[model samples]
Target: MVNETMVTFQGWIGTDVTDRYVGEAVVASFRVASTPRKYNKLANGWVDGETNWYTVNAWRSLGRNCMEALKKGDAVVVHGRLSTQVYEDEEKRRFQTMVVEATSVGHDLNKGTSFFTKTTVGAGGEADDGALREFNAELGIGGPQISSDGQALGDFVTDEPSKEPAA
Candidate 1:
């Protein structure tokens, strides 16, 4: 038997990411501040409630990428699993802590502009590839017709048109 789990948490980074190497794989760890609100009916208003701090850990390529891009105070959306562990200190006092094992992480839009790089993968229809190739060629990114498993699509294009009177 097997069980699968998924969890999403949105919060601001409480500190800069710390990166280290375990054997050959690189890992990054950081803490995030999450504020959950509560409604106070008696006061007839919403209360600025307690803030929970969560530690997030990312491994391998993701860790390296995050170390370069993520920073303190950056709002991020993290998808992963929750883990808790208990241990006894030297004084024999017991304590338990919770942390998240982040699989995929990205900056939340409220923090900054979102940049998306589109890439087409798998074996789609020939027509689709042809059209993609035409667009890619016109845009000068290898005529999207042919693509490897991890080939980069192209540059980012803005949907917003120039601000001017249409002739």
Candidate 2:
């Protein structure tokens, strides 16, 4: 069975992303809203049609980037695998959440300008033999010996927050 569906969209982020550790895995989640806008001949301006919202799930370092880079109302581009999450509330009503397992996300330059840097994970495009490793070395992303407990005498439990990708 072939059930995977790939989707790509450009829109505005509807929420702030916070990255957290979920059992040794870094995860970040946020929402992206897309609406079809067209010129309204009667009003002579752009008119928005119905808005569609999708929950974006970014994993690992890409997830970390989203946490540091994005905020509500920032225009962005996202690409992912489409999936649905079904759940029931205390009232016994079932709801299906539209979700996208985001593989790539970036600022929509059409709306505004932004800065970008290749991540330690990868270059995001086709690989060309050791390029990603070299990029990571330049940025100092993956390094050794930063124990959380030892850093602040067992008070600090998490790594330092990241600040990049201006909103």
Candidate 3:
């Protein structure tokens, strides 16, 4: 990919994620919209600029995770290879779009908080409960009680309750 264009985008998910299988490989596609803002000294406020939209495609495990974790309106950051795709309609009109073949995609931490869960894939390329248990043991915590679908059934333990000033 020496000649490929690489870019990182920060934006809000503009559409619902579409997950589909092309043969044995899964791909998840979605639209992201990024709008720029600039401070206007004369206007004494910030001005909104035109939004740029990009189509993002995540492949394989990333695609599956995206399908489960992402939704419209969520703020996210995507890093990937960028390219333009052109298509001709039946009427011979041409349409062009910017696409990102995402290498990594995640929620924007500045917008909100997120919980992290490590997914361990076994030899057969499936979630491994045993591996999760081992990981939990290494962390000196009780083994995570996982459901058949791989979701943690045990409640998360927090160090302390949030101490905020009384309103």
Candidate 4:
């Protein structure tokens, strides 16, 4: 990693995040579009420059978090290792694409405010419901309701009846 290129990009999500299992490890892939703007003294206005696109890949827990938290059009900052991928088409034309293997990805707080939720993982790499329950209790909120089959029914206790249709 000493000589490898590392870059930080601030851009808008250009495509939906897609996550899939690669041999038991999850990987999320998405595209980001970055456009540079500059102020022109003569024009007395801001000038938009050409847009550059890059593909980003995040692995493991980061991948899962990205799949849940990111959406198209959201402003985000991505920091990662940069590399180039080359391919040849059927017509014998060669193309190169920039790719970022993301180490950190987060929303641009300057753009808007966001809520933070801490996730607790158990020893087995599963969510720890006890931690969530304790947090909810501390906040004076009810914890999630779990079904007999181990599925979460609701996030908080509600006085109103269920709106979902009975299965």
Candidate 5:
């Protein structure tokens, strides 16, 4: 959908990311609130304008990462396609809601600092075992498997499938 609109919001996470299984796929959903502020020169301070709330959803690996990394009140930037839903309440009043199917979500650097961990992707595919092993190594699995020569840990990992998992 080349015509799909791309939107980004700088906001605070309004809710902790909730992970659930939709069939076999994992999805993480959270809410974010973006409020505008204006300087009140006469008052010698800044005043809050309007606040907009959005629901953000991430799927698959991104969803899993969000579940692991995001918490309520964290400042973040969400980038995704803008989507909407309309429904009527029991009283027959119509209401519209907005959501973003996030392609990427990260902590807003303007508010504070954040550390990033690179996710491993293999030449074959994201589901490949090589990528999974690399991801585990990046987390320092097995308490640093450094060789005597001080080579980088996980250098011994190979694409070959082992008959038995390492103990």
Candidate 6:
């Protein structure tokens, strides 16, 4: 039998990322706060309610990216598996904590622009592809055209020069 689970949460960063070096690699960890709304029939229709906080850890490149781009109050969507562990504090208090091991993390649309609708344009200016590019060409939203080669956008996080091979 195969045991697999996927969980998603929308939340805001609780604090700044704390990154440290473990040998030659770096690990980044942070806390996120998620709030759920509940309907109250007493004297009001709905009220902002309880908030759930979770610790999130990102490994390697993802950790670096999260550390650089994420900050307090920034909204993000984290997708990954849930993990739990037991710990003993300095006071000898035993506690169990749940954390999420995020395999993929990204910015929330409500907070800022996401990579979902990302696009680029070519000199022909007719839109690289009708299916891919959505915004109007007149808007000048698209950047340089992406080559047909294996130059994936994931390889470049910034506007650096692309090293695309010949098709």
Q: Give me the candidate number with maximum TM-score.
A: 3
Candidate 5 stretches with Cα past 4 Å from truth are 41-44, 121-167
Which residue runs of candidate 6 sit more than 4 Å off their true CA positions? 42-44, 114-167
Q: Which tens-of-lDDT digit does each residue in 55-147 have in candidate 3?
A: 999998889889888999999999999999999999999999999999999999999987766565567765556866665566444334555
TM-score of 4: 0.75
* Candidate 2: tens digits of C-alpha lDDT, residues 97-140: 88998999999999999987544443453223365346435645
State the lDDT of candidate 1 residue by residue for 1-167, as single tens digits.
14645679788999989999888777899998888778899999888777878889998767876887888988999988887768999999998876888999899997687664433432431112455566556754322333534366555555656445899
Please tell me which model should have the higher TM-score, number 3 or number 4.
3
Error of 6 at 160 (Å): 24
Candidate 5 positional error at 137, Å: 10
What are the candidates' C-alpha RMSDs? 9.6, 14.7, 9.9, 10.0, 9.4, 11.6
Top lDDT hit: 3
Q: How well does model 1 score by local distance difference test?
A: 0.75
Q: Worst 10-residue stretch by lDDT in candidate 2? A: 145-154
Of 2 and 4, which scores higher on TM-score?
A: 4
lDDT of 3 at 147: 50
TM-scores for all predictions: 0.66, 0.65, 0.76, 0.75, 0.69, 0.63
Model 5 per-residue lDDT tens digits across residues 50-81: 99999898998889788878999999999999
Which residue pairs overlap in candidate 6's backbone?
none
Q: Report how far residue 146 has shifted in candidate 5, in Å.
A: 15
Clashes of 5: 0
Of 2 and 5, the candidate ahead on TM-score is: 5
Output the better candidate (3/6) by TM-score: 3
